[model samples]
Target: MTGTATLCTVTAPLTLFAAELGMDEGRIGLLSGIMPFFQALGILSLPVVLRFGSRSVATTALTMRYVFLGLFLIVPFFAARPDAVFGVLMAAMLGFAVCRSLAEAAISPWSQEFMPRSVRGRITGRMALAYVPVALGVSWAIQAWLDGRTGLDRFVPVFAVGIVIGIAGALMLLGLRGGRAADSNAPRRRSLTEPLRDRNFVIYLFASALQSIVFVSISLFLILFFRDRLGMSSGALVLLVALIPVGAAAGNVTAGWFVDRYGTRAIRTALQAGQIGLLLALPLLEPDVPAAGALVPLAFFLFGFLFQAGIAVGTVYMLNVIPPASKEEYTALHYSMDGLAGGLATFAAGFLLAWIGAGEVSVLGVDLGKYEVLFLVAAGLTVISALAYSRLHEEGALSVRDFVGHFTTGNPMKALWGINRYASRTSEDRRRDLAFQFGGVGSLLAKEELIAALRDPSFDVRHEAIRALGHISAHPAVLNALETVLEYDGLVELRYAALGSLGRLKATSCAPRIAQFMEDPNPLLRARAARSLGEIGDLSSLPRIRTMLHDDPDLDCRLAATSALGKLKDRASMPGLVDLYLEQASDRTNRVAEPRSKVVLLAITKIFRCEEEFSHQWRREEVQSGLAMPQILLQLAGRVRTGAPGASAKLRELTSDYNAEDTAATLAALAELLPALHQSRHRDSDLAVDVLNEVRTAAEPHPALLVAMAAILNRIFAA
Candidate 1:
């Protein structure tokens, strides 16, 4: 019952909200029709909500829906001034659309979280049935109430009723529940940046967003075709509009059931083909033929039904591809892409409608509406989307042996042959199970698999091999295999992974060769090379590394330098590290008003702490007098002040052996450094006191050192 009310509130206003605003029936049709454009924008935020947990986000979205719907109702009260009221109403509509989009985003994942996979489709389909009846009822009620009345007065009551219904719907949804818990024995939090690197997920999102644009175009404009082009009366138009929900409901149920029985690929392909057929025939139907008008409702129902089913299947498809831990980020990336595409599509549809004139055009012996061209174009997009969808192989469907041979050897043709041969003989699920077995067979076999994968023709197989190599890091042969591809692979991602693998292997022999890649034209390649260099920690390459710090265009490279320098722990690089820190501090001060720049400053501070620790280690080493220990200690003291949490413990440990005589001489010379190191910024005060106590103990052994230690300690304690 709750789900039914929610669907009613969601789809009903979309049916006639534009009409209430006094838009030319055609423009109103397009206006109300394209609300999904703005709705897509809200959808992009889904990942964020999902990451935080759906329950909280859903409640928040529902509350916002109430606010927006209330504002929508109030717009009619101020309708004496049409333009202002319409503008306000449109704003309200946008707000409501965003809330509903949020609701859709949350519900899909929430449904997945709670429902069993086998029954998920059926349950979602059943829930969707609520929308059909609500849409029909709302359309009938609005058309009936407006039959004899004219002007804004009669419409005000309709909007008022909508507002009340919206509120009730929101309240009901707020009481519904299910969400992922933060403490569920899930894997450790993934790096927030990782999911963006997923190629399949990225492609899937692009296809999904494109699909949303197609649906939005059809939904927003279909009603106008019935009323204006078909010349359907208000009552007939209401019935026609109502059929969309019926069709959508049926599609949802059937698609869900089919998906449970047949899998995503089959359902998606069938529905997309069905949609193409419906779209192609839509333009041929004539308004004068009463039967032709009836076909419009059938067409609407088919498009609506199939579109929803495709979306449901696609959602399942996405969940299957992405790791469960990364679902939120994947969802976010998906919705963000959807929002962007939907917005662009809506804007494009407006221009298209105006350009093509939305009426009949004679082309290649066939009469078609400009709207039909839009549908044809949409059909073309569906084809493209389906093609992209076909590329997603089920997880673990390829053996490690097959993956490696195809990807590493750069022969994808052979890989595709193998996959097709395998597919012909085995079920996809069984093939996937075999693939997992291959993954578990240890690194040597995995290495062999990767080598074989390199010879395969499919990019998907090749890419999968690269990922598996990262996991099966026990093989030194894997490094050589990756390096072989690095010089020849067409994909930059493959090249980057190869470089990263070399670093992961700690292959010092590859250091010089890897350093050469730092000069690559691609910034990402250069950054990868720099990071790999840090991992190898070969000081012989420090000169080249230093050159990159200054010459590389990427900040990631510079950050990698700090990391590399920390690994090398070479005292000679201390000056360079200090200069980098000072440069960052200066940049921060110059851009003090920018929060993002301040974050850069924070990153720089972290690097400086690394430098400080390196210097501390150097001070503990036995070095000749020529090396200026006083100057080094003075610089090191300055670091302990602004360094991160554990600096005090480190400072005390390193300074414990300081000579009382050297301390006395340094205290006077390093008086300025003393107060900075002892500043309250060091959270571990006991460590600070210990440093002072060591200085006091040193004072007992040498009187002059005692004076110097006292002077230094006094300055530090006072500060």
Candidate 2:
């Protein structure tokens, strides 16, 4: 249909052939209206189509359109009689139009019944992809053949090729699924006015009517304008006009996805706004100007882009708006009325041109010619159409106000791209990507997609969805969704992700609820809760976190508590931080160096405003090896907090001795010593150091921890 439609319908070959038959722009415009006017009568054939079966009816009609097209080959035989040629051309084209419309009317219901809804968009998109290039290739060949031709003979070859291609496309339709014959007893039919009873659909029809008129007439007339005003050859005209389909093809790439994300109304309204601008520009492409002619290709490209994109989005809108029971009737009426409008407008435009005459009229110093006036009026109607369509209700559609933001800030298009890719993916990795895409965008559309993603059975996808909800904190539902996961979700990872996201959102309302998770047996959940409290700035949870810092059985929980204290920046937690340092530094049970040692030290250093001085000192090997050193420094911090200045000479001696100790050997020193210090600390450090060296040389292998216990008891005695 695409390849044949270009040459055999209201396109370059047909219009040029009509012009060659001595038809003016007025008569050519009337000729362009022929197909659509006949299309308005297509609903009359619906009962027959439905009874015989849609595929069969569509296939038969499609084959017959070519039979009518074959008459164009006979048109050149009557070149001697102008009267015979015009009558023959009109009659053949009228038959061609009726058959084409019958094919369209039947194909819709045939597809609706045959194709599964899930794959319809994909199948049609693939069809468009497969046919557009073939159409372009065929049109290009015709352009090359018709480049320097004259008379009706030039169209004969083009028509012959169109007939062959059109018949082949028709025959291929027989292989499609479903389209079985309806029952012998037909069901009672509803009134055609059923769709008209829908107030919103009626509103939609009004906007669609105006849009159809402008879109249909503009493309048909641009060819005539090029020929009459620019002296462009038929071949050059066809080549330049072919960009419309190319642009339309490009537009379909994103149009359906946008309709899915942003909804049909918003996408359609925006496309109409673009069409209005394109229409206004058409009037400016005046004759005898190089710049005007240079812009012709671009103008047609935009025309095709907006035209096809609008139709693509409009199809989705109609499907969503119309009920299934009356799908065929609603569809038929929409096409008939929209085509009727376009047909009438095209015929009227020709009469308008004939009425306006060739001479220019000036108003406010701007010259207005017939084509310019026609285009400008079309632009004006389109503006009104854009405004009207903006108000039509489509459930889940983006409002014009926020849809405008898609141009400035949103990922509606990017989300659509991800969704399109996501639909075909089998792997969790591929499917999980769409969940992550919603994180940075504030679009509620993205938020909705992310919410749906949460229900995805794949843990990775749901986990990412929970994480993404954290980034979009504007909506109350975002907080609610995150909290729901934190409270009831059985997946520990998803709950953990939810907790982290809640903190990222700074959801203080969820903070108290989060604090309860501090006691969760899952160490990751406990750590995450403490971390979220810090992130949420839940100062009331500071006491509990400090307790976690001192008493959490898990090393990771303790490190998390230490990091949380750093984030909270609470001066009152200094004693707990000091105790944490003292505990890690002196424990002997923990054999390997862990992040706990460095994390606690960093927290104490942060409270002291010395993190910059200590930042480079927290590497794993370096921090654990210097545990005794930080242990001494935390002792100094305690004295400083108690209003005592450290003695510089003693500090230097301790630092030098600590640097001389074997780092790997002393990694367990704090592990041995600090556990015993929970009981008490020795004031006499000299005696303890001597006992530690003696125990190191003992042949009986006395544990350093037992010796440290003895030192703690001695401190208790001293006390």
Candidate 3:
């Protein structure tokens, strides 16, 4: 599946690159459209391929694809006339498409065997990052070589090189040893529609197919629009085309990380925001201006990034909702849907281009070219697709932590709640439930009913009620009910649920009671409390929160405390915050190591206004405690000076007594901290001069750090 998908993606750009060789857009569309037809035919052969064992079938199909691609390169060299060229190109596309389709079908089933169904979406999404970069690089290099050349001669060598790469890629597949076929004793189903009968799978297929239509249309037409109407050169066009892949890569990685850490909701929300931004930005880009030309790629990159990430994340999430035994069939159905959608989109784009007259259209006082209007329509459809996809509730309705905890413990309750209570339910039901329970249900429900739901013997109902309470933000009665649960609930899950619910409700009224959980021996409870405190945005908890930053035994708890303290914007906690920051910076504990610590440091720098005052106080205290070393103190002093708004005199004072080692280390730390501090209304006067002096005297000055420092100073000075 991967190889075939890679081939199809790789070929799209090659066709686009060939279009630059004077092939009309209509012919390019036809050539691009033909491959999917063969691909669809190949997909129908999956039963035979799977019967042969996926690994063997995949390898053989990929090998044949490379051979056909090699043959394709030779066609241009041997064909004497344009008619022959067209015939050969079409034939090559058909053959290549067949091999690709077979490969896709074979691989899709095979991938399910190797990866956990829960994370299949992320795996597929991340895989695109790998394939896209390679595709972009190869396509760009081919176009670069073909620059200033005319005729099929240049394309022959370019495609010949692709053939070589294709061969290498095929050989790489040999490492995947296919497992033996399933036992002959297994029941054989004869119905062709058996797989599509799975309701969840059908919904997933529809969502995936609709999304593909928008994706394929945008991917195929954008390059031509940018080149013709926008007047983008070959080099610029390559870069623009590259953005979709690059953005896709970035979005995929981010989506995976976020889905794992925060859950599917975060990915969904982010995907919506990103897609909307990309959609709105496309028509605004002034293609004729060189400066504006950059937006074409920038927009596509962000669009591809968000859309692909969403697809990848959503796919895995949907897979998680379905039974594992059905994965192969479902995946096959997905690809089949993709082929159908791809065919329809190609045919539609070709017709739309011709119907729209290949020129500008005036809509709402804005002149948009025919292609641009197509993109606008595609973007609008994409938004609608996203909304529809978001509505499908296969996975059970659960908050991020609940979902993670449930999955980690191998519990199905979370999944069930998502499916029954959240996802599959109507929007009216969701909104009504959310508003009733979380919004003001405490006021509406009889006290007995509220208590009964809370104390329900059925764990699933209890869990759902608890989740519903989280959604009730404005209801004081719900807040009170959650508080009662927090005080009495025996189950750890129940207690965590109450805390999480209160937090989401932003029940600041419960802040005092919630603070007691920070001292709970259970690390999970403590972590949840800290997160709730941050969400509540109550400053009263800052002292205890700051203490937890250093004293909590669990790293998760400590990090949560750090996060909470930052959100509270409590500058009085700065001394403790700084201590935690330095410890995190210097500690070798892998448990506490994460990039979020930088965010903590950055947050502290923003809230604290008087670094010089804090440093002077620290120096005095350290001297009095008999724990201060002049060298360490001097470094600390330098950091303070570096952070000051206009501290030339202070920096000069510190520089006079600076030990070489202390100065070097302090300089490095300051180099890191300065920009973060500089951005906080602290850059002015001769602070830049002092930093320059410190940079010059450092034993091992980092060139990159120095450059960053210079850029910071320049921005400050410019402002």
Candidate 4:
């Protein structure tokens, strides 16, 4: 971790120094290929690694790495010999790369064999946390020290710092305690070629190898692109280079948890597919474009960030796939393939760039250089790789579409974040918060957590978990648990929560059981049950709910029943509803209109299919008029049904005269229906026979009332 503070990569000051010599893109590619190619060659150390403990072999090789780096640092002093500079520098780098390769070959197997699997991931994370800030700080400091200065003198200080820190890190490797040399005679030992025979592992290796070319070369090539193609200053490029590690740290932090939550293959597929789009966009970001300066660095940042995440998930997947007995062989084989793939392609890309030197290709009239063409090719290859990643088997992993859907669906990540938060937080408020988060997701991923939470000691947590279960759809466990709570749970609140969740889940199978609760002593339980029955959409519960609406003394019971009847859209309930509305409308003792009256009006509108027509919210002037209007309309329909005198003609006139599409129309129709019912030629006929008998007096604001009053006044004077 400390050694990474030196910031020695194939890309940065190394590329900058390589370009300072007269080497073209070809030699730079060759130089970039050196470390990975030697790392690939390090698999030859398997015999040596097996002969000694993993830590011992890795430590010895890493110590030699620093010695080579220290020798490389002295090359700047011999800069006076211009003819020998390239050979001497190459020789020094060759030695350093070989030693580094041997260390690389030993480290993974050592960690796998000796370190606890639980702590390996944590240690990797802690190392990154320690390394990133130092790497960023050191990079900026070096950029400042360089200050656009060129030549061999710059190489000495950078290499010296790396050697010092790297040597310390190497020596620190000695502190790690346990790993035994492999026993050739042991019965449990598996063949080294066992991983090769794994079809899924081979497919994974193929995909990884295909990706490695672009993966390893992208940083190095971008540095050259910025330097030669865009004319960026050497010092400024240092900061640009540092953005890679910075972006990687951010990405790794996010993926570290996500891989565990969601699993690996789906994430890998999503990331690789996303990277394809990024690569395709890169060719369009030419120097002349308005955002190219910013976009280019952004490309580098994402390149590092996304690949770091891929590595994280990929490592987890590999660990899962590898057999317990052959961890060393599996790891070494994987590293060898990765290094070889990266080495060969990077080495080839240099020559390919050299072949296309200072040349341009016109595609759709857009002038693209070798870098653009290479990125296009990389994008094409990435498509194949992403598809390959999709085919890799991961048990219990969601399909790519479903995994991606979590981000777009109702705050699932927040829910996931809460699920992780639950174990650490024991307070009732926090536990309840966890339940709230799980409820919003509406996914079965939270089912086990939410259901287990149902039995939590904290009543708040249990009650909230009951509510959260309503949000997750189609789980037998959730539905069954809720039913048990509703039927048998002692607490009324939990039972109430269960009923609401059943409604949200549309658990129609529970409708009959829920209907039984409508007759319960608790008004709260009765109200919740009625609503759930309505949402479950079982027509059998309609009669019971209508009876509740007609007879229940509880305000909440009536509200829920009326709402249920509305949802059922039952025309049969209209007569009783009109009776209720007329009683409430004419009751002048109550200053404020009752809420049940408004809800009844809404329910009636829904049944009549005129809900959209008279949908404005009720106010002081609107309530009585609104309630009376529907009452009159329902009564007229009832009369027309029974063939009362002039009833059919009156109803036809009312419908034709006022469309019932506006408040004024309803007011006008109510006025006419009042007279037709009140002053029929055959006054002996029963106009109110089919409905409630309490509607003899016409509703107010009638011009006919003035005439009737005048007639009565004349009669009074004559008497």
Model 1 local distance difference test score: 0.59
Which candidate model has the greater lDDT, 1 or 4?
4
Q: Clashes in model 2: which pairs?
A: 585-670, 586-670, 586-671, 586-674, 587-670, 587-671, 587-672, 588-671, 588-672
- Which model scores highest in lDDT? 2
Cα lDDT tens digits, model 2, 1-719, are 64655454447788888777777777778777888777796678767765786778889998898788777788778877877877787888788889888888877655566545444444445555666676577667778888766666877877777778778878988788877666677574645888878898988888888888887788788888767777888888877777777777666655655665567777777788888788777766657667876788888788877877787667667766677666768877877888799889989998888887778867689988988888888988888888888888877667887667544544666755665566665588766776777676644556666777778888888888888878765456678778788765468998999899989889988887899899898999999999888888898998899888778889789888888887888766666665565566555678543335556656655544446545533332244555434454334333323222333233334445565244333323322442333333444343334334433432222122222222232233334
Off by over 4 Å in 4: 2-6, 9-11, 39-51, 77-94, 109-126, 148-150, 183-185, 285-297, 362-367, 410-427, 430-456, 468-488, 505-530, 538-565, 570-605, 610-719
Q: Model 1, poorest ten-residue lDDT window?
A: 699-708
Better-scoring candidate (lDDT), 2 or 3? 2
> How many clashes show up per model?
35, 9, 11, 0
Q: Residue by residue across 1-719, what tens digits does model 4's lDDT show?
A: 44462485334777777677666788778777877777675567777777786788888888776677566566566666644666666776688778777787778777665645444444444555555787678778778877756666876677677777777778888888765677767754435578888999998888887777778777568787777767888878887777777767666665655565566788777778767887777766656989777886787778767776676667767776777677777877877888888888888888888988899877789887899878887887778877888899877666787666665646666666676778685788888887887887776667668888888898899888998888877556678998888765469988898899999889988888888898899999999889888778879998888889889998678778877776777777867776765666556777543544666666665654445433432331254433333334444445544334454455455545443235333344333344344444442223222221333243632222121221221122222
Best by TM-score: 4
lDDT score, residue 548, model 3? 84
Candidate 1 residue lDDT tens string, 103-194: 65665556556777667667768867866767777667766776657754565566566666666666665566666445545555534476
Shift in Å, residue 452, candidate 4: 7.4
Over the stretch 1-719, how does candidate 3's per-residue lDDT look in tens digits?
34333433344446554565556666676777665545555446657654776677777877787676655665656455666667777776777778877777777667666777556555765787776766576546655765657665665665665566666777677786543454567885523365677665566566666677776666677777667766766555654566666777888876774565345654564576567667666766674556774556567778778787877776666556555555445556677777778767877786778667656778899887777777777767666766665555644333433433433432234323333343233454453353344323322222223344676555655666777667533355567788878876468888898899888878888888988998888998999999899889978887778778877777778778876776676655655665555555545576544354454544453343333333344345335532223333344444445445344344345446644334355354445445434455543324444434444444553222222343334344334
By lDDT, the candidates rank as 2, 4, 3, 1
TM-score of each: 0.50, 0.70, 0.55, 0.75
With a 3 Å backbone cut-off (N, CA, C), the pairs that clash in candidate 4 are none
